[model samples]
Target: MTTRRNFLKGVGASGIAFCSCGMLDAARAQGAAPRSTPVMVKGKRIKTVDVHAHCLFHESLNLLGTEEAAKVLPPTKGVPEHFIVIEQRLKEMDAMGIDMEILSINPFWYNRERDLAAQIVKVNNEKLAELCAANPSRFGAFASLTLQVPDLAVQQLEDAVKKQGLRGAAIGASVMGQDFSDPKFHPVWAKAEELGAVLFIHPQSTPQLAQRFKGNGWLSNTIGNPLDTTIALQHLIFEGTLDRFPKLKVIAAHGGGFLPSYAARGDHACFVSPQNCNAEIQLKKKPSEYLNQLYFDAMVFTPEGLRHLAAQVGASQLMLGTDHPIPWEQHPVDHVFATDTLSDEQMAAILGGNAARLFGLKEV
Candidate 1:
C-alpha cells in the first residue's frame, strides 16, 4: 500500500541507522584495542617520578587546636578546613601527569613542648599511615616525629617504619634553635641510618630570626627558610655528622640550600687551608663528593635551572618535586619536559625513576 517514494525513504532511513550503528561498533572495537604506551616527548620516550609532594588533613587542626598549633608553630584553623585532601591530590596528580608523589608533612617538624609535639606527631603519622593504607601504590609516607625528644623520635621512627610501613622520616632543618647536627641528635641519626631511612630535612622559620627581622618583612620564609637550610646543611657537613653516619640518607630539601652552587668555596677552603673551615669531621674526599652523593629535588622552577641541576648532579640523582598547595604550583616534571638537553632516558630518571629506586617502589 505504500508508494515507491515512501519505500525508498524508509530504506534510506534504515541505511543511515545501520551506518550509525556500524560507526559506534567500530569505535567500541577501537576503544577496546590495547596499544603500546610510549612516554614520548617530541617523539622521544621517557619515564618520570615525583619525589616530593605534601598531603595534609583537615582534622589535623582539631587534633591540635588553634592556641596549641600556634604555640607549636603558627596557628591555623584545622577543623573544617582541609588544606588538600588525598583524593583531590590524586586527581591533581593525574592532571599534572605525575607518576608518583613522595608525600610528607613538614608543618610540625619542631615543637619543644614534648606532650603537644607528641600528640601532633601521633595525629599526623596516623593520618599518613591511613592514607597510604587506602591507596598503597599512589601514596608513600614520610613519618612525622617529635624531634625534641630524640629517644621518642627513634621510637616513632621504628614504629612508623616497621609497623606502619613508612618509607622515611621528615625532620625540620633546626630543632628548638639547635641544628640537627648537634650531638643531642646522634641517637636519632643512628636509628635512621640503622633503618636505612631517608631523612627529609625541611626548613622552618627560626624564632630568633623572627624577632630580629620582624619589621624588615623578610622574617617568615623569604630569607629565613633558606638561611635555616644553609646553616643546617653546613652544620651537618662540617660538624662530622655525615662522617659519623656515612650510610645515612640525609635529603636536604630546596636544592641542598645553596650548597651545590657554593660547594667550590667549601672544597677550596677545606683543601687550601684546614682552619678556614670549622667542621670537626675529618674529610677524606672533597666536599663536592658528598654533595654528589646526596639527592636533590628538581623544584628549581625553570628548565634552565633543572638543566644546571642535572649538570651539577648527574640526571640520575635529580628527582621531580612539586611543592604543591603552596603559592607556586610548579610541576618539576613539566620543567624537565621543557628542557631541550635531556634525552628521554635522562628525563625518565629525573622525573620518577630515581625516586622509585630511592623509595623502593616496584617498577611502574
Candidate 2:
C-alpha cells in the first residue's frame, strides 16, 4: 500500500512553484510519478476532478513593471513552468487521478492601478481560456478579473464566461485589503449570479496578521490563509452580501478555510453581541446555515477533516481539490476514498460528480 508518506514523496520530488505565495521552491519533474489508483465505486470507475488548480501567464509576468521581475515573479520565475507547462501539468494531473482540472490564477494584480490591472487581467483571462480551449477534456478555467474596478470586473466576468468558454471567475479573499462584503462589489456579484458563474475565493494570507505570523512554520499560510477566508466568508454573511446575492455560487479553497472548523461560533456571534453586527443588514439565514449554500474543495488533509466538513456542510457541497503543483493533497481521489464515513455515492460526489455538475462538464 502507498502510504501518505510515499504520496508526499512523489509531489515533493517533482512539485512545481508556489507562484501565488510570492515565493517559489520548485523542482523539475523527478521522472514520472506512478499513475494514480483508479477510483471505483459500486463496480464503476468514477471520474476525478480537481477544482483548485493554478497557473499564471508569461505575457502578464513582465507587465508587473513597478517591481523588478525577480521580486515580482515567483522564485522559479524564469527557470521552469513557462517552458513545459502543459505536458508537465497533464502528467501531474494524471498521477493525482484527476481527469480534469478547473484552473484559476490568483489575483496578483489586485493592487495594481486600474489600467495596469485591466491589462494583466486581459492577458491572464485570454491565456487561460486559450489553454483550456486547447485541452478541452483535461482543463477548464475560472477567469481573472480586475475586481478593484467592479464595473470592469462585471464586464470581464461576462465576457469570460459567455465568449471565452471559461467556467467562472477567480478572486482573492479580499481586494487590496477591501473585504468582499463592501457594497462596491455588488455589481460584480449581481453579474455573477445572473450568469450562473462561480466565484472562487483563494486566499493570499492575512496581511493584517503579518507581525504575529512572522516566526516559524510558514504561519502566514498555515494560519493566515485559512483566517483570511474565514474573515472573508464572515463578512459576506455578517454584511448580508450572501443574502443579497442568494444564488451566487462560491467555492472557497483550502476547505473553505477555517470557517467549517469553527462555524457554530458564527451562529452565536449576533446573539452574543448585537452591538457588533450591523442592525441595518439582517441575515436571512444563520451564519452557519449559509455554509450549506456555499461549496468547498476537499484540501483539509485528513479523512476525518473531510468527514467533518461533509457533516457541517452537506456532502453534496464537497468537491475534490488538489491545489495542484503546490503538492497539497496530491493523492486527492484516494483521500476521498479513504474517508470511511462517506458512503460510495458521497465519495463519488466529492471525487468529481459535484465539480463536473457545477462546471457543466460533460461526461466521458
Candidate 3:
C-alpha cells in the first residue's frame, strides 16, 4: 500500500525533527564541551580513539581540475580538503580528549573515469599514510579506494594496509547508484577480509530524496545522510552480502544511521510482508543477528541516545566518533561518560579500547 505520494507525504514534521534533534543536542553540548585531554575512567588515564573522523587532502582535490569545484564542501557540514592544520587539529583533539584519531577521506571520486579515480585514490591514501607517519603517536588513518573498479579496489586495499600502513579503507554508502550488495563489489569485500582491513562506510546524502529533503534543518544531511546509510546497510543485510563475507570487518557511521534505531523491524519485515522481501537471497542469520558482527560509532547526540543505541547494538560494538571540524559532535568524550548505564570497564572500552583492539593501536 506504499505509494510514491504516500512516501513523499511521509516527509513531514518527523523528517524535520530527524535532522533538527541532533542540532538541538549539539547546541546543548557546546556549553559542556571539554577543554583538555587525558580522559580518565576509574581514576586512570585512557587513550581515546575517534574512528569516525573525516578529512580530504587538497592534493587529491587538484585532480578534479577546478579550484572552486574541487573541494566538495556541503552547505550543512564539512571538513575542508585544503585545511587540516596539524596544530589546530591537535588543539581540538586535546579539548575533545581524543588521544588518537583515525582519519579518512569520504569517497568523492566514484563518478570519475577509471584513470582519474585511481589517481585520486593514490594521492589520498598516500597523503593519509604520510600524515600518520608524521604524527605516529597522535594519528592513524583509513585509506581511500576506487571502489567503482573492484579489481583496482582490491589492489588499493592491499597496498594501503601492507605498504602504506593504513588501518583500512573508507567508502561511501554506495558507488554511483549501485548497491554494494551486488556481486560486482564482492572482490573488494573479500580482499578486505583477506587483509583484515576495516571497511568504514560513510553515507553521502541521498540525492534521490532531494525533492523531499528541501527547506530547513539541513534535511539533506539530517534525513538524507542517515537514510542513505540505512538503505545501504539494509541491502547488505537482507541481500546476503554479510553472509557472503562473514569475516569482513565493517563499521557504520552516524550510529549505523537509522537502522539500529528500528532494527527489530528488519526481523519482522519478511514475515509481515514476504511479497516485498527478496525470496532469492536468503540470509544465513536472523536480520538482527548480522548487527552483532558489525561495528558502530557513538555519534548519537545524547547520553540517553547513546544508551539506547548500546542497548540495541551492545556497548562492545560502539566506539567514539566525532564528525569533527564539522560541529556535529561537540563533546564526544563527555557524551560517552554521561551514559550512566555503562560500567567503568565498558566506559574504558568505549572511550578508546574498542578501537585500539580493532585497529591494533597502542594506548598513548
TM-scores for all predictions: 0.80, 0.88, 0.89
Ranking by TM-score: 3, 2, 1
lDDT of 3 by residue, 1-364 (tens): 2222332243342231111122445644544322356665655668889898877777888788785444575554544422588887787777666778889787888988999999999999889888999999888999998998999999999999999999999999999879999999999999998999998999998988889999978888898889989999999999999988998888999999999989998899999999998799788889988888899999999888988988898888989888776778866866776677787878888889889899998765
Top-down lDDT ranking: 3, 2, 1
CA shift of 293, model 2, Å: 0.6
Model 2 lDDT per residue over 277-317, tens place = 78887788888999999999999989889889999999999
Candidate 2 is scored at a TM of 0.88
Best by lDDT: 3
Q: Candidate 1 on 1-364: residue-level lDDT in tens?
A: 2222332344334431111111234434644211112233333333445556665654665567767655443333231213556665665565455645667788564643777778778888888888888888777879988888889999999999989988889878887788888899999999998998888877886667777767765556656766677788777777777888888886667666667777777767766786776666677566667777778777777667777877876887777776553423343444565676777677767766777788888756
Evaluate model 3: give its TM-score. 0.89
> In model 2, where do residues sit more than 4 Å from their true spots?
1-33, 74-79, 82-84
| RMSD value for candidate 3 | 9.6
lDDT of residue 189 for candidate 1: 92
Error of 2 at 340 (Å): 0.8
